[model samples]
Target: MNLFADIRLAVIAALDALVAEGGLPAGLDYANVAVEPPRDALHGDMATNAAMVLAKPAGAKPRDIAEALAAKLGADARIMAAEVAGPGFLNLRLAPGVWADVVRAALKAGAGYGRSSLGKGVKVNVEYVSANPTGPMHVGHTRGAVFGDALASLLDFAGYEVTREYYINDGGAQVNVLARSAYERYREANGLEPEIREGLYPGDYLIPVGEALKAKYGESLLGQPEEVWLADLREFATEAMMGMIREDLALLNVKMDVYSSEKALYGTGKIEAALKRLEDLGLIYEGVLEPPKGKLPEDWEEREQTLFRSSQFGDDVDRPVKKSDGSWTYFAPDIAYHFDKVERGFDQLIDVFGADHGGYVKRMKAAVAALSENRVPLDIKLIQLVKLFKNGEPFKMSKRAGTFVTLRDVVEQAGADVTRFHMLTRKNDAPLDFDFDKVLEQSKDNPVFYVQYAHARVASVLRKAAEAGVDVSDAALGAADLSLNTHPAELELARKIAEWPRHVEIAARANEPHRIAFFLYEIASDLHALWNRGNEEPALRFVQDDAAITSAKIAQARACAVVISAGLGILGVTPAEEMR
Candidate 1:
């Protein structure tokens, strides 16, 4: 129900009354007026700058405006007090019934309690996990995958039509490396000692790809030269690697809506079409770029190359699309791919890149700006590194991914739900530490367990109530006389439940999914605190001696569980029904 928005609307209506009664100017701009939580909750539930923002424009003192505004707002049924504080801030405290209504609203709305219409169904494309199809996904790519998937879900919850996409980097030297790597596996399948060359992939994961090639070809590609079997084996090996990647994502419950291959764009005139559109707009030209700031490449030479006028769109300098040798640089297909996305009529595009790709953000944004004619906006989120630990020691590397820890290794150790939730516990641009020991710990220090433990605790209460012959269905709980829950601890939880819808909008507007994680943690903390409180005072417990009073209080606690479950659902984490 967005209680904050409801209160803000009431405040605005009172201000409108002030203008109508001739106490204020005729058409004062109220856009700057805001109703939000007080800096210190000790002040009140919400505070607004209605007085100060209007004081300068109205040629009146802030106290005069605040005093006049307070009298009008004091009459609203929901507002218990509208006291003017420091300068012109209007601090408000809503009645206990207001918080009580929030609990009822949560039970009625269920998991869809915080779903918003902020995006209004705008089309958005999210590109993530664009790793080369050379091997299994590693820890770095895992963060990107989890971040992007959670972002897409968050946007969808905020009423955006989100499309999860993956760009396959098969149109480069990496795929050729995959081909050569598979060629050795092919020989290995032929009962010969395969040479694990210095540059070739040395992972044992390709052993199965070797075995699969033998079954498919059956001596057809035996003893073949590089040119003879390169193309066939490259396609096969790439598919096998992608299959493994899909399985890895499936473990974390991440599913992509689309998978775009860079190789599919080559030789199809798509690159020419996209670049020609830019050229016609005077964005593409043949030029020589100044050498990068400090150390230059050993073979750095000034040569004319095809370039994009990225500087016009806010990049540091014009970027090269084609190298001096007339071959397409790595950015050529990227431009075409983004252009394709722009042509698909998406209102916005978002790219989740690793922190190492920070340098490419500006140029990529510039390309989208030029290609979309400044109509579409692009947001590139750079996910910082993840450091893994076990019992406070660094986790060892995986032999499958050949170097770093693979996503499968982490999932195998911590399980998919723990891995996903722990990965998202930090901001996308901040470093995250995934400690196997800490995550699996069943204490309040572990957020994943704490949140799940809250849900499971609620389940235990419901089961106990059912065994005692009490009807604990959501309909019954929502319909219970929750006015009996007048304890301060119970009221505080109800107030927190009221903040969910507003928090959803704030989190969606900032594009920060971590805020959702933080909110869920706070909700769990409040619930757990109340649970602990009951241990001291038996009267505050869920199952009281009186069945009717028990239903009233248990309903309030169950409502809190409903909101937590919904929030965790948006984050793609499974709420524990019972802690093991």
Candidate 2:
């Protein structure tokens, strides 16, 4: 029931008819032809660029082709009028019955109304929030978590087989630092004043991990050397940190389908195998990298290293896989991890990283390209920072996290639904300001509140109709005679509802879940505008004196609610039946 898509097909069919009638030459590629909502709603319900796109290709004037295409499209019963606008743009006004059918379709489908098959069930692995297994997730990781989870849900709605994954950074030197920090805490738990060192993690979240360590290893590890206890404590502490991270994610209602370990690639043949695949293609070699372009580091030296020829595959330079010290660089395990992803047979891969990792994008894509021989596509989305404010002032750091705000702190204050919705209010690459006071305020300025209020208002309408003895079930509403919904306000809301499936496809194709939030806000604005109009004209009220009229109006409101619920479901936010 995508009216926009249906109209595009009609326009294409009309162009084909023109070719058949010998009015236009054959083979005028129609791929660029599009039927979309008019820029100005007052102009028409939909607009098409078939004439403008085909004019030059067909060796015809724009207006001439537009007039011919308009005449051909006017024959369709769904299109009430097709008027040529500026320079060959065809604006279309759809029949009222067409809008009525869109409402009926929404009511019939309920939560499944806007689901799309854009991906055709292609397997996509979405790796996100792969923060170091050292401490609780911070505000930065929270944004990535929300964005990734919503993206996974959006892909699922768009018919992609999505796997939500987290890659644990346990093999890095950071985890060894975590081990030393936890050992100090273990000594603290054993009634000794622990050394609060500078390099070790200082968060109180790991104090429990230290206590747990004492419970497991007891005082036997208290006086041992680093070798005797470091490895065991590193494994134990990482597991505890991961457990805490899982709980933090749960607080925001985020869950992962897989958890990959960086440590698992160490001492395994996976890294060697991934590099071997690149080496076989003559992409791996030992060479000296040129000095960096900008200000060179004080200790900068042009030393020979094992490098991957990433420059051939779009990276700025060949990236090193191993350092001069004969140890794997950070890029080595990453290449192996992505190679593992490609080997798992996923058709596509998506990684959600913080904006600081922007420089790593090209190199990572190059690695995946080399590993999959360009067969698998990798899309990396970098989420920017989130600045928090309380009462218009900068929010303070979390005491539990020691220096930064924890995900749990934000969730506990703003709630999971509000936090998730607000996090997506801005584009992923754009910095976001999370104002605690503004987000929770129950005003139209707040998008989350406005959208939720729309759903709640619809529920109120249904309840009032039901109490008045009007049948308000979806089956009844969908079957209602909606011809009475001829008011401009009512019709406009239906127009917005018809755009749901089209918007879903657009957002999913761009891999931008933030678009869904914007769409929801627009639809909610329309719904609120219509609801407020009813106060000025009692006849426009949903619960009319006549049962048939009330049923029709209720049906329209229910359809809007249906789309809102579906959009919220994709965002992992529960729709409110009644806002408290």
Candidate 3:
């Protein structure tokens, strides 16, 4: 039960009653009316803007409307008090029983407590970490992978039919680079000094590909021309690299529903068909673009080329689809790829891109808009960079990836769970500092362990209660006398628990999974606060002298565990049963 929503409904009903009593207009729009937690906890349990929002529309004074609405709301049993505040804001204090009911609801709902249906079964395709299929995923792609996977899980929990996807960049020059790099490995495997040239991937991760090439063809491909062996090696090397990427993603507990290849769109008429569709709509034409504003390239020329009128749909300027040499530009295949997604009948599309791709956002949205005729909406989320630190110093780079760190290196050092949770400690757009020493610290300063410690403490309490001959199973704890939970600290936790459903809808609507991590941290703080208070006042402890009291208190502790488990589940991190 969403107590906040229930209270909003009550406030709306009171406004309707005021209209019936001739205190307000009958037809004032109430869409802007909202009920949320008060900015200050001392204000009240919840606050509503019904009076302030309706005053002008209903042709009534703000305070007058607020007083009338407060009187009507205060008459309800669940509302202990409703006071009209500055300029018609209405603050409400809920009956203590409302919090008790929330605790019981949490126990009954377990892991399903905060699941929402806000998405309403809409099909959303989330494409992320579509890195070039040339090597194993590095630290840059790791952030996208974690963010996308968590978002997919969040949307799924919030009732969206989500498909996790990866678009492979196999049709670009990058694949040809992979082929040449593997050929060197092939020669190296055949006992010859390989030319590890410039402009090609130099990571040792591809050593296996060279070894595999040697096994497949031996010395036959040693003296062949580029044409004779490039095709087979390109296909073979891309598959192997993708395999390694899949393993990297799986290391972080991520799996894509589909892996689309740009190569698959080549020579299949898909690109031509997509451009033709745009051409039929008068969006495609041969034109010359203005030189970039700041600095023009030395070879810049105003040459005629096939272009898409991206500015028609909100891009800064028209963009070239085909170069002057008649070859498809990078944007051409991306347009075709998105067109293929739209044709697959997806109602919505979400692309999670790195912050460097910020320039591509508008043009991509324009492409989807023109292709789908604005029927399908695309949301692009840009994930910023993650800086790593260890022992109060910046984490150094890896020689293997040449200039950057690899995902496996981070995971192997900081561990997957710590890495996942710490990456989400900040919003996607904000910079996050992953300090290896700070994250693993056992103190409350570390959010990951703090949250996990809360769950582990709950398990400890359950074990202690069971050993004391008290029944602590879910069924028994759920049936306990929850009315005994009247302490302010105990009731405050229940109030936080009641906010879960509200938090889920907010995070999902904003497409920010980082909100879940923040909420979990707050919940864990409340749980830990109560645990520490038990030391000062023994009555606040989960295990008590009497069986009835123990059951009631332990039930609340278990309820906290239940919510934490559900939140961690959405984050794809296993909730700890006990701290090692």
Candidate 4:
């Protein structure tokens, strides 16, 4: 079903035959050989570097090997022509029937069309949206949530056993600040003046948490010392914030397989155990770190601390695990968390962090490398900022969140599908601008609407054909004489459909789900182009005077929908059945 893959296999077989016939030397590695769309479409459908890569290894001139490989490939029924280009590159043009077969394959596969087995069912843990348990998720967290959720789904579609996880930052000082803020709100709920002081959360969202706290504890803990109530209220507020975060994620239809608490890492000996493993590996040492490279902090001093030899693996410098005061540094728990993931036997670990965490990437990677002894691979994706705009101006801040725009605000205004799709229009590490009016516009320039419109157009085609008494069922369309689809425009769309499976594997292999959005936009562009052509070209219409031809044409449109729907599913967007 993967046309490019099939063609690559044919090319490999041709090379194998060349080796067998003694036309080429024996024992040449073909692993570096690749077949892909040419940089310029006019060059050919696909271009392979099989000869270019093997010429030196096989001890033959590039031209001679390319000519030999060309002859073998030209004999393939699937390849219409195989010609050698400059420096021994072979350009291949597939037989026209191959594109027709792509339509049949898409129709036969339905929603499973682009699903790939690229990951080989390896266990992958994707941890994202681990926003501090302080308040509602903001727009920044929204981007991370959407990106990570889509990536996990993409990996799963590519046959990875993906686990969506959220690591709660409750053990940090932020949670302590949250407890004090909630305590103030709890006082306000108990009919007293609340101190919404500096360095405290002032979001109106905490008012409800205050009411809940009052209901649970009444006035019994009023006026208690910070020591008496800090721990209890910290736990309480963290849970309350997590409840709101869960609701926020649900608004976007994101559900996690696991929720890990950083506070739990304390008192569980897990952090100590992780460090012990590092110590056993000789990666842990007690020493004074050199003063950091840049401007010295006001409290900077060279003090003895427990450090991890992170630089040995690939970090800017060694990282501290414990402070001079014997308290675990922030890096300690993160290492333990990742160690827990490794111990759980996940084949790979992916951390979705904000752009601000870029500096932590190397050290985190070094830790996982040392702890897992390089058995587990760690990939940390840094999600960049999402700037919000309405019309042409910056969107106002969320009063509920007290500073930034809340995830709920964005989702409620634009709806989940629009928000998710628009968020992915750019790379994860690139900044994105979410303009409410632009994304909801019913224009082809808007990818969200454009892609959805393609699916809806296919739906419209099916409805029209069905009303005209054409057998538009998948079985009937798949059984249609697809060879009747002879129009160049129609076959071009089929060719695009054929690229879906290949693009899925490519996107999944790169761990970049945004590429799926990019591919969806491209294929949608092809569908829209063909749909427009139908307006002036009657023969290109989906519903024709002849029911059989109508079935044939509608098969192509349905095939378009099949790949579009499958792609949108990976992005967690519902394929629109009709355009509004």
Q: Alpha-carbon error at 3 in model 3, in Å?
A: 1.4
**lDDT of each structure?**
0.91, 0.94, 0.91, 0.92
- What TM-score does prediction 2 earn? 0.99
- RMSD to the native, candidate 4? 1.0
Stretches > 4 Å off in candidate 1: 26-29
Give TM per candidate. 0.97, 0.99, 0.98, 0.99
**Lowest summed lDDT window (length 10), candidate 4:** 539-548
lDDT of 3 by residue, 142-204 (tens): 889999999999999999999999999999998999899999989999999989889888888
lDDT of 2 by residue, 393-465 (tens): 9999988898899999999999999999999999999999999999999999999999999999999988888
Predicted candidate 1 versus true structure: per-residue lDDT over 235-284, tens digit per residue:
99999999999998998899999999999999999999999999999999
Determine which window of 10 residues in candidate 1 has minimal summed lDDT.
217-226
By lDDT, the best candidate is 2
For model 3, name the residue pairs that clash: none
Off by over 4 Å in 4: none
Query: Candidate 4 lDDT, tens digit per residue, 309-366?
Result: 9999999899999998999999999999999999999999999999999999999999
Local distance difference test, candidate 3? 0.91
Q: Assess the local accuracy of residue 355 in candidate 2 as a C-alpha lDDT between 0 and 100.
A: 92
Error (Å) of candidate 2 at residue 520 is 0.8
**Could you tell me the TM-score of candidate 3?**
0.98
